[model samples]
Structures are given as structure tokens and as C-alpha cells.
Target: MMLSFFDQFMSPTLMGIPLIALAIALPWVLYPTPTTRWLNNRVLTLQSWFINRFTQQLLLPINQGGHKWATIFVSLMIFLLTINILGLLPHTFTPTTQLSLNMGLAVPLWLATVIIGMRNQPTHALGHLLPEGTPTPLIPVLIIIETISLFIRPLALGVRLTANLTAGHLLIQLIATAAFVLAPMMPTVAILTTSILFLLTLLEVAVAMIQAYVFVLLLSLYLQENV
Candidate 1:
């Protein structure tokens, strides 16, 4: 008998996700070190000047003085990258393929773009929301189009990651499942498909990294452009 989707959900490993999250979060929660001090000083052995250069641009003034949003950004990228890359293991799956998870990462960036833009340039941000020199007769049409595009940026970001990563993962899964089903009947064919699928899973890991880079780069660009 073939397995059902619900059969996979019933596995004990599903509980591991929360445990993994706790493991990853333990440093920040229990030990509670400053991200700037932790990452800048020793995490990657990054030089002080290098850390200062990036952190200066995004320092947010808080009660303790300037907190490094730059470090936070780096942390976020690293965490997401690890999650994606680790999914290539035989028994693991990338949660980035889940729409809810991808959107959780994306929606904040979208909101941050608007918030930072407005904070940096109050009057100018309103103007930047629409293009310059609109024809009087077509101003309404132009506004509508630009507004839609602006809103769609984050939606596009979410869809790109969710669709591509999920599709690639599902393709690998189907190929592996096929190989398993055929193994007893056609040993040679099963071995060939499984070999190819394993290679493809490795390729998918590279793709995951590329997607993360693209997403983060685009986010940084939006910050620079709007601010």
C-alpha cells in the first residue's frame, strides 16, 4: 500500500522542529549575549572596522543607546541559510518551503521598508511612492499602478521562495519515492534514479543559498533606495 500525506505528518520527527528552534535560540535566550559583541568580536572573526562599517548605517537609538540592526540582519540571514541548507539531509525538509514561514520573514522586511523610508525622508517618501512628473490626465492611473506594484513586492518575495523551494523539494521526494517503489522489481533502475536524486538534492542546497542571498540583497537595496 502507498503512503498518504497524513502518514508523513504522523511521524515523531515533526516534534523535532520546535526542539531545533529551542536549540538555536538558546544562546540568545539563556546566555543572552549582545549580538554585536558576539558576532562582531568572535562569531566569524570579523574585524572591528568591518563590523563598525556595516553597523553604523543601521544603528537604532534605544534606551541603551545605538543597537546594531546590522548584526541582527546578519543573524537572520545566517539562521535562514542554515535552515535551508540543512534540509538536504535524507530525513529532513526545508521549512522555508512553507508559505507561512517564508511570509513571516518577508512581511517584516516589507513593513520595515516603509517605516524606514518614512523615518528617513518624511515628505520625500510620499513623493517616492509614485513616480515623478505624472501627466495630469493620467495621474490617477499612474498612482493605481505604482501602488499595486509596491504592495506586490513582498508578495512576490514570498512566492519566489515558497514556490521554488517547495517545488524542488517535492521533485526530489517524488524521485526518491519512485526509486524505493521500484527497487525490488528493477534494482538497476532504482539505483540510477536514487543516485541522480541525491545529486539533485545537493544542487538544491546551492539553490537555497542563492535564493537567500537574493532576498537579503533586495531587502538591503530597498533600504538604501528609500532611505
Candidate 2:
């Protein structure tokens, strides 16, 4: 008997060692490395094409200085894309579903952008705390509000990724269980539920891809402001 649906979100373990570490590292191993040859393999060619296109589209709006982050952001986007999709497979654990793992990724990168802004343009960074043409009565309140929002950016990033993935997974599991139980009692209802599950799976696939893009895109936006 299942006690809680949330239990599936818990990090799986083997021999008292958390398997989330292995899941995190698995994406790198799965990627095909490029070989030095006159003609590259299809996998290597396709990988290069995708990365080039993604980097070009992602960094087009940012300044020259922000272009330096192209490699970091591109790599992160691929890593996230891989992990998010892999979690959809049967019996697989998704590290991104854990708020701790998401925050670990979010906080450092977000902090780096903030630090860059402060170090490179202190006046401009502080200037964001208060908008131009503000009334004297609201200046203090606005500053406090902006400061809180600034700090909340990382939290929002982590929570957004976690919530989207977690909700999709929970719904999938819930519907699957219902279909299983209904199959024995009412085959027609079970078939309809199964059909719905198939459509939901397709939607979840799109969500997985989109959430990965949104995560990296927001990080790039943060870097844009600082650089």
C-alpha cells in the first residue's frame, strides 16, 4: 500500500549511498564525444549543430562580455535537457525534482551574476534598487521591496523547475494508478484513462524540454543585466 505520492520524489539509495550523485553524473557519460577524423560520426555532427544553433540564438541579444558565458550556459542547458528527459523513463530518479539540487545549481550561478554586476558597475547595480522619478515617501519602501525581489530570484528559479517537474510526475503516477485499478473493474474506463495517460505523457515531454530552456534562459537574462 502506498502511503504518500511524495515519497517517489525522495532520492533513491543503494547500500546507504544516494544514487542521485550517479544520476547527476550519468548525463555526461551518455553524450557522444567528437572524434578527430576527416568525417565525423552522425552523433557528433548532430550534437555540434544543435549546440551551435542554441548558443547563437541564446547569446544574440546579450553584449560582448556576456558572450563569455556562452560555453557555460550552453553546457548547462544540455545537461539539464538530458537529465529532465531521462527522468521520464521508467524506474529512473530525477535529481531536478529535488529542491536542494535545483537550488545548488541556481544559487551559485545567480550569485555569480549578482557579483559581476556589483564588481563591474556598482553604481548601476545599486541604481536598480530604486527607480528613477520616485516620490520621497515611497523611496524607502521601494528599495526594500526591490532588495527582497533581487534575493528571491534564485529561489524562484529553483522552485519553478521543481514544481513543474514534480507536478507532471505526480499527475502521471496518479492517472496510471487509477488506470491500473480500473482495468480489473471496468475495462472501458481503463482504456479511456490509458488514452489520456498517453496524451499527458506527450505533454510532459514538451514540459520537460521547455522547463530546461526556461531555466537556462533566465540565467542568461540574469547574466545580461550584470555584464
Most TM-score-accurate candidate: 2
lDDT per residue (tens digit) for residues 1-227 in model 2 = 76698888899999899989899999999988888787998889999999999999999989898998999999999998899999999889889999999999999999999999999998998999999999999999999999999999999999999999999999999999999999999999999999999999999999999999999999999988888
> Per-residue CA lDDT of candidate 1, range 41-74, in tens?
4534543444465445434322122142466566
Q: Report lDDT (Cα) of residue 212, candidate 2.
A: 96
lDDT of 2 at 172: 97
Question: Where does candidate 2 stray beyond 4 Å?
Answer: none
Candidate 2, residue 151: lDDT: 98
Write down the TM-score for model 1.
0.73
User: Looking at model 1, which ten-residue stretch has the lowest summed lDDT?
Assistant: 59-68
